[model samples]
Target: MALKPLGFYQRLQQLTLPAQQAFMAALCERQLPNYALYAQTTGCGDTHALKAVLDLVWEQLSVRGASIDFARQAEKLVECEPPADDDSFGARRALDVVVSLFSLLDTLRGEAPEAVLDVSRTSRAGVRAFIELTEGEEDAQRLALLIRDHPLTDDENGFQDAVLDAVSQPLNKALLKDVRRLGKNDGVSNLGLSLE
Candidate 1:
């Protein structure tokens, strides 16, 4: 027999806390390295930069308990709902970061496979740092050595700009496209929150 449909809220409800936290953790893990690269290249070396998104997701999921559901919160985000209180600011930022990163990920997946490889390679040290932070791997010295050994020389600046520029517009366009798509699809999409 055909199954009945499930709305986004219903789907989220079906996810036990372990499953929800696991999904959130995986989402956080997926971006750790690339964001580490972005932070380092942009000269923001603080590891907290890497944790920002994860912290927000945790706040939404754990701190808020089951009340602040991901789909409901995401709906608020898609609808551009104003912050109901101080904490909502964190929620908004969390939504923006996830949506933006997810869009960039899509672009990297479909358009610039080479960039994805380059990111993986270039982010080696940062990834190690991330691992050390999250997993207690004790690789700080190695991460430092890796960074010091390969400073961005003058000759590489042009290549760096070329690589970065190629993805800039596409990233922005993807974010806009997703916002529009998610906004249009909210409450009506075939796959519910999974449509994101």
Candidate 2:
């Protein structure tokens, strides 16, 4: 979303309760496509929008004691939505976007819930992934830490090395590229939201 006109994504970072409630009303009605389009054109964070949309969907279903099926729902909303050119490339591209959105929201669960809620725009599976991670034991934490300690952007396997060399803070050069690059001034606009 930040790559698009992500104003809403940024606003979500500081969204008010009343604003959230009001948005939820519209979002719950499955009218999120409009807002999603707006967010996309604005080059904002899709992650933020997906999170909100997912949350609204979860609330509606959970409140009604409904069965939640993210995979089936993902197919209906995204998979079956044929691309404009009837090309598989577009389908793959769209699927990639959905996957990216889900992955990002899953990452943000570590953030403050309010802040995360404002910036996330994930689906049920994404949220459930986040929830599951939160419920993990030391094993999970250790695995995540391992990933954070390493990235694939350094050495011969700079990216591979980083992931294998995962460590705690005091991030090393091997993992420098593994961390957030959005904050850097590399003569290119950084998204600044890589996995940490």
- Clash pairs for candidate 1: none
The positional error of residue 106 in candidate 2, measured at the CA in angstroms, is: 7.3
Top candidate when judged by TM-score against the true structure: 1
Cα lDDT of candidate 1 equals 0.35
lDDT, residue 70, candidate 2: 46
Residues 1-196 of candidate 2 have per-residue lDDT tens digits of 3565445345544444323332322222222332234345444335354544455443432343544554444443443233445434223333334443333333223233342342233322223333344445457776555434433111112321222223223333333333322112231111111222
Number of backbone collisions per candidate: 0, 40
Q: After aligning candidate 1 to the native by TM-score, how far in Å is the CA of 187 from where it should be?
A: 33
Compose the digit string of candidate 1's lDDT tens values, residues 4-79.
9774334433444333332323333433434334334444333353354344444443342433333433333233
